[model samples]
Target: MSIELPQRPFFLAPLDRENSGVDFLGLRQANLDMMGEMIPSINNVTSYIRPFSLLSWIYWKFHDLCTEAGIEEATSDDLRLFRERIEVLFTWGASLHETAERIPGISATPPPDQDGVKPLTFDAWGRVQSSTSLIAALWYGPASKTVTGLGFLSPVPGRGGFFRVSRAGAALAQALDNKLREDGERYNRLLGTLDPVEANESDAIALWSLWSPETVEHEEMASFSSALTSEEAIGSNDTLLSRRSTTFALARHHLQEVGAEQSIPKIRRGMCFSVRPDGSNYDVPTTLEECRRKWLTLQMRQLQRLALETLLSWCEDQILRYDVVDTSAMAERFKKSWALTEYGLGEARNLAELIFKLDTKSNSVEDFIRSVNTNDLPDPFSIMAEITEKFRQRDPGFAVPCFFGLLQCASFAGAENAPPNMVQLGSAPRLSLRVLRHRLVGLGDVTVAEAFEYILEAMVISQHFSTAVNRFDGRNQRLRLAIEETGLTALVSSAWVPTVTEDRLAMLLTLSAQSDLVSKNFDGEFFSNGGIKNESI
Candidate 1:
């Protein structure tokens, strides 16, 4: 996302416009023709301009121009002009050569030559011998005046082979080496400066070492062989086979360690099973079905444990977030309601009461549902719908109990027992009686019964089972017991039982509320007073 403008395009003007006599199109065609003949010569002279192919071509062209100019036997002044032109061409070529040498993978050494004067000469095969030959020819023949005063050429005997070494030549070689060393040092520094997050020094070093001439030559040989061999094997099947074998071997070891003898027979049966005796490509099984089954069972068992832990954590977090008004009083009330003969119910009730008291100001069905951070709460509507569908597939009539069981789970205070019931409750009966009764009483802010009925219908349609009647039943029972303990309900009737109604749904709701009230009271007391401690311990 770095916002930066792109570079502008570069356009080259027509050469004909710069040189009136030059036909840009014709010149290009002529150069293409010359390129066909000069490739071999260019290759031969490449050594002198080591890394620069374009520079080698330019040097050859300058020599050709000198020859065409007929300045070989010209006056000193004319020769000076010719030498200056050739010198400019040579300088340009050298600059290009140096640039090519800096690029990774390009050869820095120039081509060599035997006959120095005719540096542009090619062998019978049209291959230029070396860059040295090209440079020597350019200097001695075309730009000879530049080096004549410098004593670059020495006279030889009758054969006309002159011993030649110009100060410029020596200076250029040193300069090339120095430039190369500087470039190498800069490259090393760049490699060292790379961000550790993107690339480490080791990686940079490996890349640099890989570009060495020796490494390149070795790689070239390997690549050439690979190219020649049409069927080059890049990866080995043996490695895959070894990995699969190791996995099965590990599984077998684990089975033996666990003393699972039945698994051995299963494994043996799986191994012995045959699909077909014919040599068909699909006859063999790629995977061990028996091993996979055993692994899945183990994985499911681990997942069940994780699910329980997650539920426990959710409950703990919910309780921790709420504020209790009267922990001791709530605990006492909880103890008496459940008729505790053991500590299990007492302790559980005490914990529940503490949470309830603390969260009393903010306590609501929505808060409770939100407190349960299980993955099940994310899309309750869809999840409930899916469960209902699953139940319908098994037995449509059972969907009601399935739904009620799910509601019960949402209302209840435990975790380990919720999932299986929630899953199976989809197939149960429509126990709306208890749910309806609780909704009427719990949501008594509206005096009209129609409002409660509307709420119930909406709850069913939206799958918002979190506010179903059983939750109110549980909460009311706790509230009544708390009131009893505190003597706050002396003026009101305490032993009232709601009348049963012909509306089956209403009756069911009332019945559910009554049942939950009695159970919660009894269980709360039992746990509060350590009645169930022995059983649990």
Candidate 2:
């Protein structure tokens, strides 16, 4: 069995560009014919297997080659090698396609398993992983002309094709510029309204306003209309009320730490005297009077809470239905569902809910605020603080929650975190796997079977701890008993086994046990009953 690659047009009317609009149907047909002609040459016994399976083998082979060569940089030579490999693979792929078409049942062949090798299943969704790896490789590898050649067939012009290559280059330049612009815009927006006069005076007032619920309430209805009108009439050009609002907002930010050094005598005395004891006079005030003025100025220049609140309300209204939280009238409906409390997960769920809600109706800012309790939910600053604290703690459980919250919030604001891998999984598991694999392959520190034993032992221990306090039903007694009886601690402490291997095994077993328990408790037909099939996974 063999397969052929799909043909593409060599030249087509510039799809969405200027000055080139000629139909290239003949070129496309010709390309396809060329691909067909090349297919048979690459066909072999392996053509009977699935195209994806063959692709996996090719990819793994490349990985092994790269490892052997220690080729982290995509130099010209590396690129040449890659191109050759890709060309060969493409030819092979085309043959497989042709064979599959010729032999109807070719895809049904059981994929081969190499000696002592685990049968590798090609994930249909592996495209995402591949894309991720591609990005990583490009980022980490040295610069190369190979990228240019690689992009020759890319849909985006300038990126690959001669005509479009400049466009791609320009696009990259534009992207960099856009990023700069965005960062500039954000910086300006955050500090945009800052007036030296206001910043020096009103900062304290703003801080007080944000932290004090009483002040917030008072300001909420404190005649913003009057304030705006009065500020406008002052011919100040800069609105005092708007500035004040900004100050308050900044004060509320988790990153901003105010009044932390107020108690130091020297600092306090200097603040009060406007002069140091050594007689160095300062331009700024030293008394409460001066402090009040500075605080007032800051408050005046700061962003208004009402405006921000309104903006948030508007965003909420726009995306409430997609909220992942409990939306049904019956609490029982979500009794079995995961109840995430960490800010990130909650925020993610909330944002999802908001999105769903927006689809149902044209939500207004007022409606959004009225519908939800803002006080109960942590503010953005608080959420950031939570994430930071969790990260500092280096607790995976805590980190996951924070990561989820940050991801959701950033998404809601139409921003994405740097890279998925940064938050994909913890470093511990990845590092552990790498270390163990290196020891096994490079050092021959342990037999393959011994390695497996160590890994399983670690997994069992982790499983015990994770299930010890199961949140699902608060009933993980059996799991706890199993761990205690299994001598998990003793297994973990075994001299010959690596800690990581033990941890890995424990985590796996815990997951398995949890799944089993969920299955036993839930209706047999339910997806959570442990027989659930996931297409994506």
TM-score of each: 0.15, 0.17
Model 1 stretches astray by more than 4 angstroms: 1-287, 321-537
Model 1 Cα lDDT, one tens digit per residue, 1-537 = 333533885433322321121111111222222222111111111211222212222233333444676645333343223333222323323333333212221222323423431121122113322332323442223221122211222333342322233333233223333333444653333221211112232433333332321122222223222211112111111332222232233233333333322222233222222211221111222343332222222222222222222222222222233222233332333234224232111242232332233233213333323332222232222333333353335332222222222223333312222223222221212222223224433543442223312332333211212322233332121111112353322111221111111111111111112212111132211001111011100
The model with the greatest TM-score is: 2
Across 1-537, the per-residue lDDT of candidate 2 in tens digits comes to 343533873422222322111111111222222212211111111111122122222233333445666766324344333423322222222323332123112232233334532121222112222222212222211110123221111223332211122222232323222322344543233222111111111322322222221111211112111211122222121333333222222221101122121222222123222333334443431212322222221111111111111222211221232222211211222222224443322332433342333212213212221222223233323443443454345332332333223222222222121122211212233212122223223323342223323322332223333433342232212221122332322211111110000101111111212223111112211112222121111
Per-residue lDDT, model 1, residue 51, is: 21
In model 2, which runs have C-alpha deviations exceeding 4 angstroms?
Answer: 1-376, 407-537
Highest lDDT model number: 1
